[model samples]
Target: MSDVHGRSSGTGRLVTVLAWALLLIGLWLWGRGVTGVPENPARPGTGDVAGLGTATVPLPPAAEPLGAAPPQRIDIPELGVQAPVMARGLDSRGAVDPPPFNRPDVVGWYGYGTAPGAAGAALMVGHVDTESRPAVFYKLSTLKPGETVRVVRADGRVAHFTIDDIRVLARDDFDAQQAYGPREPGRAELRLITCGGSFDRASRSYTANVVVSAYLTGTGP
Candidate 1:
């Protein structure tokens, strides 16, 4: 009986792994479209400064990328956001698993991707709202360029970023690479993502995603 139980448990784990693999493949296909090319341009629609090549205000120059270090906390002074950061992996649905509804004040960093201060676009996601009220990123879309976003790192240094772009990308033609990709090569960039547009009752999801792009401008102790 013990052997049989062990075999059953092993089979269950295997099935779970297979299911995740299938779901990831499906998500990749859906995002890449049938022809393996993105269905829309890198920036589509008029979601707030889509046609504008740069921020409306003058911004500081990009700082050199820092070495890899896990992030501990994030602060957006303009939005009055000072939240703890937790590393998160992909969920069963093959997407970044955001903080649980109960912990709506937390931010989830993509653990499998670039570190917050590394030379790549680090991805951070949070819930815009729970069933009852607003979440951590509820005011994310309201952030304008030139605002400051500071990330406290585990290495005892704070990475300061300057907001450069904001886009409300439609869900129908969402391009992961474009939304999360580094705007400039060798710069340590960050993308803060949350749900935007209007919530749809039929689909039970937001019609678009709010993507706020920023790059490292300086560091602090």
Candidate 2:
């Protein structure tokens, strides 16, 4: 079934509204001011600050899809990142809750939504940086097309996804359907999200969000 965002339902509208509200709340909690739009977060002439370009890379034809299982760990070999996965729910404000600042090493999976490797989009979010130092997803913007992200499941299966695109969308352009909804129907997808772009000293928040889009390409034991 298509997700609520794809349909013309009241719930879908609510989700979209809540999603956008959460974006603002997240920025606020992370130290960004609600007033005044800042410049694009990414450096000029590299990737545009508004959006990241997308590429259609097919998953490995031989790979089999896995059943729904909670993710236990995540490994990005190219980035040398290996961290435990923690299930996180939305806050009272209906935003995807982030891991505590004290545990910068942990990544939060949107537990209320589709699990990783399931036949839908799975979301995982991390901090770009803590108040004092870099966080688990500080290098999220560095991920390139064709890289792989492996999510080990509680059932002992690993769902491997291929990076298809990376985008840094300004807060004003943040789209719930694009950021949190499914990319392709019947395909298992993954989104690694974190704050990005230039840090706005005046606002005390990052001006944009770095979103890495990937699709299930293969699986492992």
Candidate 3:
């Protein structure tokens, strides 16, 4: 991936790989738990305590899941983001590949996972910064519950999700299930992820991850 100036940089590549590696480990653990594989005990602080179940604002009930369709774009009105969505596969290291660094305004969806409005959690990842400038999800941590996220699908339907939980999960104690797992059985869920917390210049990566959880509350043509 290219850097902010459209030139490939070693730092940019390192940051991208390290950031996605955090989720790769967590997602692997989550898959293990689902398949009846014995799992490692979670660390004491792995829970989403930063902003757990604190949505005092009432949210609408979840809508029924729609048929699978690829997402074409994503809109976060609260953050002033209207970015194209592209399917991303895992990198050689097994981490979910992110959007190219030059395209800082785009969002990457985990193409192998659940579709946005499907009956499971759809995973999306974006860059918080591109070494020099803020990226598509730079303001993701500031989002509050009850805000709206709209995903335009290829089937010509807009899946509107309502934000209900946000967390800054420390990398040392990250929990994949809590960050990416379904909040409620049979509800269409979405997870927007980006690097968060203070950047570690030494490691060229952030210390934590911002995960915004939402559920499908309505739809539009």
Candidate 4:
């Protein structure tokens, strides 16, 4: 089953995610000119923030793939984020597994692709907010470009990424090319995605998706 985006879709499975991504544009029109409401207000989280590359800083170059990975975990003390390991590969449904958004306990694996440290954008999608809780990505938008975001891969290696840019792009703008673009050799990049901009009550969605692009840096998990 291919998605409306011309990607694979198990209908029930990938459709919901594609809907959230695409419908965000409709939500934007509905909430025109509106910013996000304080749905789950908390202390402002911190990480490196870059604004379209104006304040650029040097980053560690991409390295060789670590090949097979050893067991590891991803932890973010700032947001109290901790999650177990899950390998993301193209599933039968053809859609990726979305990261756990509302709750911080579970982590999302990039459902449609490889386990990030492998090659392309280690795409990780988390819930900006679920019905019951403030998901792991509740504060993702707060991250600025050039800010450092780290990931501990299963292979006992840590890959650090310095954010390059943060964009509030419509679902229409999500291209597999950009969304899952190639990374530097041995360097692992990542993209954290979730609903952003404005949320709609009627459809229960957001106006846009916040995509944070980061370049690779650092060592083991």
lDDT on C-alpha atoms for all candidate structures? 0.72, 0.71, 0.73, 0.51
Q: Please name the candidate that would achieve the greatest lDDT relative to the true structure.
A: 3
How do the candidates rank by TM-score, highest first? Answer: 3, 1, 2, 4
Instruction: Give the total clashing residue pairs for model 1.
Output: 0
Which residues of candidate 3, in runs, are more than 4 Å off?
Answer: 1-53
Clashes of 4: 28
List candidate 2 segments past 4 Å from native.
1-52, 56-64
* Candidate 4: tens digits of C-alpha lDDT, residues 1-221: 11212334476556646544543333333223132323433322212223323225654555554443422455544456665645443333344445333344455654433344554456665556555466677667666565766677655677666677666665434544444454344445676665665555654446566667776655654
Query: What lDDT does candidate 2 reach at residue 164?
Result: 84
Candidate 3 TM-score, C-alpha based: 0.77
TM-score of each: 0.77, 0.76, 0.77, 0.63
Q: What TM value does model 4 have?
A: 0.63
Model 2 clash pairs?
41-197, 41-198
Model 3 Cα displacement at 197 (Å)? Answer: 0.5
Candidate 1, clashing residue pairs?
Answer: none
**Clashes within 3 Å, all models in order:** 0, 2, 0, 28
